[model samples]
Every structure is written in C-alpha cells, then in structure tokens.
Target: MAENNDLASGDDILASYHLPSPKPLWLNAVYARHIVRGNFMALSARPPTVDMGEWVAHQVVEHWRMLVTFIRLVHDKDETGHTICNGRTCPKMSAGPNHSFTWLNSRLEPVEIPAYEYLSLVQRYISTKIDDAAVFPNDPTGVSFAPYPGASSSPSSPPNSGGGSGPDWVGRRSGFPQNFLDVCQKIFRQMFRVYAHLYWSHFEDPLYHLGLEKSVNSCFSHFILTATTLDLLGPADLEPMQALVDLWAANGTFPQDSRAYGYANLRAGERLLALAGATTAV
Candidate 1:
C-alpha cells in the first residue's frame, strides 16, 4: 500500500526525468538520510585495523545477501501465501520458483551449481557460521569465477582459496537470463532518478515570495560545495548536485519564504554540510 501511494508521486518525477520506478523495497527508506548514510558508509575507508578494500567489498556482498533474502521472501509468499525463512522455517530448504535464480538462469545461461545442495550451502553461508574465510576457501564450490568488466582474467576465478588471497569474488555468470539483468538495471536507474528528484525538491526549490528562497538556496549551495570538496561524490555525480544548487540560486526559496518548509530544508542542509566538512577533514 505504501508502495502504491509512493508510486503515483514517484511516477510524476520519473516522467519529468525520463526514468522509471525501481522495485519498492529498494528505495522506500523511512527517510532519505538513511540512504545517504548507507552510501557514505559504503564508500568510506574502513578502520585502521581492517582491510579497507575488503571492507568496501563487504558492502556489495551485503547488498547481494539482502537481495537474495528479498527474492526468497517473494517466492515463499507466492507459493504458500505465507512468509518464508522468517526465522521459523527450515533453514536448509530450497528457494522456491519465484527465486531470483529463475530470473537469473533464464537471462544468463545456466551455470552448474552443486545440485540441491546449493541452497543449503547458501543458507549456511548466510547464517555466518562458516565465516567469510571458510565460505571463500581456496577452491570454493558452487561459485562461478568470472572476470569483472574491467578486470584482468589472470586471477583465474577468484583464487579458490579464501583467507590467503582475500575473499573469492563470484560474479554472475555471463550467460545469465536477460530479464534478470533488465530488472536489476531498471531498479538501479529508478533509484538514481527518484533520489535525484527528491534531492532537488527538498533542497533546491524555493519556498516563499520573499528573500526566504535566497537564504535556503544559499544554505543548499554551501552544502553542495562542502560535499564536493569532501569527495562524497565523484565528478560524474556532481553535475546533478550542481544543477540543484543552480536551480535554488535562481529561485530564491529561503527560510523567510515558507517558515516551516524553509526551516526544514535549512536543517537538512546544515546537517549535510557538517557531514561533508567532517568527511573532508578525515
């Protein structure tokens, strides 16, 4: 229901930007700040004691884990009209027909997984009992070792051994079903578009007829500048942020305009500015 409610407004923004909506769960955070926080954490350098590269890699790994969980949930709901794997079900059970495996296998050519044992192994991996080292052990089973688009092929399928060379990174097989990639891409594109719109509306738009707009826009400009300086976004992503700043500058919608909205915008802007400054200082 919340998804449907968001869909109408989200659609309008997407239309303006020539994009589509991503899957609901992907973007429906209680607040935009949550998404921002996740992005920040994903990109930041890990603690001094930890392997920064591996730590960053974990972010992507975690995302995949969540996606798999979501696919399983949808499948169970479709098959039995009840929630699956919500802590009560048998952990070793196979993911049903609605699983992402169906979509992925259809789009990409089928790759060998160790028969019915694949799901059980995956479940164990998810439980964290095996540890990343054990799960990624040299010559790990049931994994497809493919080079990333820009990576060299010499690594020869993720080193098979785990802790010695780091976690073996498995990629989706080249021949995976087309529909699955389409869905994934569609979801990502929608996420980028909707967040861009929300960012503009809340931080770039003017609020009142007075100098309130100008003040709000000024705060937003400072926030953007600080964010850029901190490297929170790369040059490629900075363009939209700049555009938002320019829009606000031209519109003059500051706190003096609509006190409530302008004030809220200012508060968020201040927080973002602080985050940017802190990041840059580090």
Candidate 2:
C-alpha cells in the first residue's frame, strides 16, 4: 500500500539523520566547581592551570547537546505542527524591510541580528564552523546541511577524530590551524541567540498552539540546569526568564518527578542561579 511505503520512507529519513543525546542529568554535578582552601603560601597568587580551550570546547558541546535534545522534544515529527514563520510572524517584520532583532551573545551583550537572516546564518555557521573531524552537515545523517538558497555540494567531510562527544570536538587538536576554543565560543554565542529566540519569541505558541507545555518546560529546564551547572551561561543570559523559572519551580515542572534524573526533589531553580553566580564572571 502507498501508506505503508510512505511509512517506510519516513523511517529511512529518520534513520539517516543523527542527533546528539542528552547526558544523564546527574552527571552535570560532577563538572561543577568547588572552593578548596589551601595553605596561603602554597596556593600562590595564580589559580590552578587548566586547558582553557579544551575546557570551553566541552562546555560548547554539552550546551549543544542539550539544545538538540530540547529541539527534538518540542518538534513535531509529523512536520504538520511546527510553525514556519517565514519572516511574516516575526516582530521585526512589522518595522519595515530593514528591521533587526536584538540578540544576546555569550557575554550577555546585545547584538543586531537582521530579520529573516537567522535561519540561513545558522545553517552557514554550523556548516563552516562545525568541527572538521565530525560528519559534515550534508552527510546523510545531518540536519539539512545545505539549507541556504543556491547552496550546492556539502562541505568537506573529514574522517572521525574519535572520542568527540558530539562531532564538535574530542581528541587531538594540534592539527587544527586555528585556536579551536575561540571558534567554539563563537559557535556557542550564536547558538545561544537561537535558543533565546525560541524561548522569548515563540514560547507561547509551542505551549498553547502545539500543546507542548510539558515538553517545552522540561526541555528548557534541562537546558537551564545544564547550562548553569557548566558555567556556560551568565545572569544576563537567564535574567529574561527568571520569573518563568520561578513559576515552574513553584509548580514542580523542573527537576521532574522522575527517578531517571536522580533528583526528583531537587530544588533546581534557586540552585541554578546560585551556580551561575558562583561561577560566572562580570
């Protein structure tokens, strides 16, 4: 039957696409920093030495990992539910052709992102900046690698570098000609804007129109919790939704009552901000 064939085709499409999986939520604590007092003389003026680049890369991948997880949670598999704004519904659209949205970056600084430009920019950013070691976006298992108009041919797909968490980076960086961590930070800054736009601009549509409150709230909580635990986000990055978070916590939407997360009774909201305050720099 045609319906059966279509079902099989759908399975094939899903099978060819690859997305990162969420880490066990409890594992976030393992990466949290703690204060350790030492002999004043022995401690020295400088703090402990660390691989700053690689460390930031880990944060980048983890944040992306959670972002992908949340996207999957809220996206309708049938493709009938996800709203295609196509620029008309965007607030910037009403201000004439030259309008732009003020997007927040990794440092919480506001930047001008032009209206209707994000989708293509994101596709280009992911295509060009993604780790050369991982599968290029056009590799059958990617998220529509060549998304921009007139784009043809995928980027060069490099062989696996092995041990990378999510095709962002993993083992061996000496071969790279650029400072890898700086690139990762750039990627994170842009990606954060994407997340902010989703929560800020489209939060209600998904909740009311799509009936995805449970999924949206849960996914966002995970995103906030993970970002907080990793020192990837600062106060300014989260301030816009502080009230929403409080409301969710008060209603028991976060630290979901599921044993799988290992923290059903955890007070996540306050702790999330606390961790950010402890780690984030001004």
Candidate 3:
C-alpha cells in the first residue's frame, strides 16, 4: 500500500499559482485511477501484478501535481472580461477571480469518487478476457506446416537447402514462402483486431458518452505543452495524437464536455511528465 497524503494538503502547490484547488483529494484519486488504468491497459502486454494498489497511489499523486500545474497556466493570463447576462447587465470578472469556485466553467466541475472504482473496472475487463481465453484458438495439429524443407527451423539455419530429414518438396518450391507470409499476415490481423476491440470498448464508448470534441482539442494543446515538459514525445507522435484529440473534441464525444475534457487532458499531461521523469532518472 502507498502512503496516503491529505488531498487538501496540496493547497500550497495550488497557491504557487493564482488558482483554487479543484476538489478534495479523494476526487482527484478517482480521476487518477481511471486515467492510469486506461493507460496501463493500453500499454501492458501482460496482466498487471497484485501491487496495483501501490501503483494507483503513485498515479494519483502524479495526477494531482499535473492538475495543479494546468490550473496555474490557465489562470496565469492577464485578460479581464465582462459578460452581459440579460444583454443589458454586465457581470464583471477578472482573469483570475478569487470567487471562481468552478474550473473554466460550471460544466467542468470535478467529480467525487475514490480511485478504486477505476481499478475495479480495469480488473473486470481483464478478468473477462481471461475467462474467454478459448476465443483465442491455436492450431492443434503437430505438423511442421513449413513452406519449404527446414523453413520452420530457426533463421540461423540455411534457407531451404533441403538437408533436413523432413517431407520432400513436390518439385516446385512452396509458392515463394507462402506459409511464412501467411503466418506473418495472420499474426498482424490478430493484433489489429485485438487493438480495435480494446480501443472501442474502453476509449470510444466513454468518449461518445461524454461529447468531448472541444475538450479533446484543448487536450491537444495541453499535450504539446506537457510533452515539452516530459520530453517523451516528439513531433511525429504529438501531431497525430493532437489530431485525434481535436477530431474527438470537435465531434463532442467527451462526457461532460467542459469538465471531462479538461480533466482528461490534465491526466494525459501527468502521464507525460511521469514518463519524462522516469526517462531522465535512467
């Protein structure tokens, strides 16, 4: 288990800038858990370990720090403004009003939940896959199925010299490595299918429910800034991820368009920073 820091204790971090702490520590934990679980599942090739609790705690801390930094930047601007409520009455506001209890707007208010909820959701998905292992079938036959004699052997061996005591090639060499190409093609297809399923099941559904086009666009901008801080992503990856976020944000696929989008972008920024820190230490 990880050490529990008072969520409210981070007020000092928020004080460094002119922004209010968005919510209590517990709510931050919930958001952190959801973002970490999604990221872990996307990146992990194998099942996660039992030490996930510790990982969750660490992720929550990192996420909180990222949130603080983001709030500071958004409020750091010196632009003041007024809104005409009834088209005749002006409500005065500065760029960084102390009365601003909400983040960006009322629609972007943070949620209150523990981080464990997200961990449970990820575990459930993994468990479902484990229970359905039979869906991923392999060949039962022991036959070599090599395209040519000794082709199934390691690459260290000479190619198709026919020195091995295996089945004879019927005069014509097997169709220009058809079996090798077939296996490669099959593996590629399986990988893509799995990626599509997981992406849709985890990310697409939530985005669709959230109506997040604008938020995602904002995330793209945040990604640029955060990526610079972390130094893990280059222009190639950043550009594409930004484009994807923009597409989704514009399409209104994020939940709670204002809040969800900002929060999600904040989480991504946190992950980038963490990655950079880890890389630097290495």
Candidate 4:
C-alpha cells in the first residue's frame, strides 16, 4: 500500500475533500458468497500463487472491464466518420490543443493526444483483435491455457498486435514471462487514462445526471485499490487523478487506511504474494 504522506489523518483527509461516505457494496453480498463457495473455494483452497504474467493478464481484463463500462455511459455523435468528442461533450475533461491527456512518452517526454483520437485508436484495436470467446472456450472442468505466443508490445500506444483471449487463471497455476507482463502493464497504463479522463473531466451532466456517479465512483475506487494493492500503478501514472483517488479512498469507498482494504483479496491469494516476494499484507 502507498504510504500516506505527512498530509493528514483519515478524518482530516475526508474532511479536506468534503466527499460523502461510501456505501458498502453489500446489497448483493449473498450473491458474491454463492459464487465464491461454488466456483472459487476449491481452487482457492489449493494454491494462491500468481506469477507476473498472469498478474498482468488479470490487470488487463479487470481494467478493460472498467474502461468499457464507463465508455458505455458516453454518447457518441460524429458528423464526420470520427466519433471524437472534444471538450464540447465532456468539457470538464477537455485538454487544450486537441483535448488530450498529458503523458510521458516512451522517451519520458510529455506528449498529448485528444481523447476522441484515442477512442478511434482503441476501438480499432479492439475490433481487430480476435474475440476471447472465439479463442478460449468455457470448460466445466478447469483448464490451463498458456498465453498466445508471438505477443509483443507495439512501439506505440494502442498496440498493433491482434490480441488473444482475455485473462483467465488456467486450472490452478499462475506465471508469465517478463516481456508479456510488460505488455499487460502498458495496456493498463493507457486504459487508466481512459478512466482518469472520464472521472476528472466528465462526471457531471450526463454521467451524474443519469445517476451513474455511484456506480462509476465505486468501480473506479475498486480499480484504484486493486492497482495499488498489486503495485500495478506507479505514482507518476496515478498523479493525474491522485487527488480524487485520495478523496474517494478516504470516504470509505476505497479505504486506504487499513492493510485489509489495501489488499481485499490477500486472504484467498497469499501464495501469489509469497511467490512474488510481495509484502502487501492483509
């Protein structure tokens, strides 16, 4: 877990942000328990190890889930073939030039690209990839599927590779090569910008007006907490929306005060940390 700065205590932090209390996602508690008992208990009971590759794959799938969910909330209108919405639609998040988020390029130099421009790139990327269901079939019995070979990072964002199946823990094992793991990391880093722009720039009007804030905030909180738990996001990557993350975290939506909150899954998956020599505690 990232340490709190000399900033303040939990109470002060929440007050400073003037955020509301977070509701427990307990309405469907029984539903979750049922799934775990039926599907996860046996597997979790056996081993908790997840290596770097599997970890990255897990992050990709989870982050993609959040990204797509939020994207669905957006209304796209384009007179041109391009569906890029400048700050006109989401003024809260519009960047100056082409309305792009500021990011450090591979050379570590700052670069900016419009949000709509990115949507085009990402949509193209997703549409071209072979869908996961087509590649990996569901099995009643657990089965291990190694990552597709020939997977490599694109020299640019919005990878050039036509991808493979979504991340899944094969039967009961976990591990991946460093290069493949890096690909997952890069994918997540870009996808996170998608979340940051939505939460920071356009959570009002349509998003909030449609009563989507609770769902969005809750989902974003989970993403933040999970990313932090796994050390998936560096401080620099998180800096853009760190303040909001801090606010939501303090409000109990994603409590950062306890190790328990830091790693909500540690109890069931301690062996993963053990294998990785990670010290993120429960």
Candidate 3 Cα outliers beyond 4 Å, as residue runs: 1-158, 161-177, 200-277, 280-282
Q: Over the stretch 126-151, how does candidate 2's per-residue lDDT look in tens digits?
A: 54655555422223232112122332
Query: Is candidate 3 or 4 superior in lDDT?
Result: 4
lDDT at residue 123 of model 2 (Cα atoms)? 46
lDDT by residue (233-260, candidate 3, tens digit) is 3332322132222222222333222322
**Candidate 3 least-lDDT 10 residues:** 37-46
Better candidate by TM-score, 1 or 3? 1
Which of the two candidates, 2 or 4, achieves a greater TM-score against the reference? 4
Ranking by TM-score: 4, 2, 1, 3
Q: Which candidate ranks first by TM-score, i.e. highest?
A: 4
Q: Of the pair 1 and 2, which is ahead by lDDT?
A: 2
Per candidate, the number of residue pairs that clash is 24, 0, 15, 4
Error of 2 at 231 (Å): 1.9
Candidate 2 off by > 4 Å: 1-83, 91-115, 134-178, 248-282
Please provide TM-scores, in order, for all candidate models, with all chains considered together: 0.25, 0.42, 0.19, 0.52
Give residue 69's lDDT in candidate 4 (0 to 100).
64
- C-alpha lDDT of residue 187 in model 2: 66
Writing each residue's lDDT as its tens digit, candidate 4 over 60-100 gives: 56557666866755536545643335645543333212234
Global fold similarity of model 1 (TM-score): 0.25
Q: Which ranges of candidate 4 are over 4 A from the true structure? A: 1-52, 78-84, 87-111, 125-177, 255-282
Candidate 1 lDDT over residue span 133-201, tens digit each: 432222334333322233332212222323364334322232223132233333322222223332332
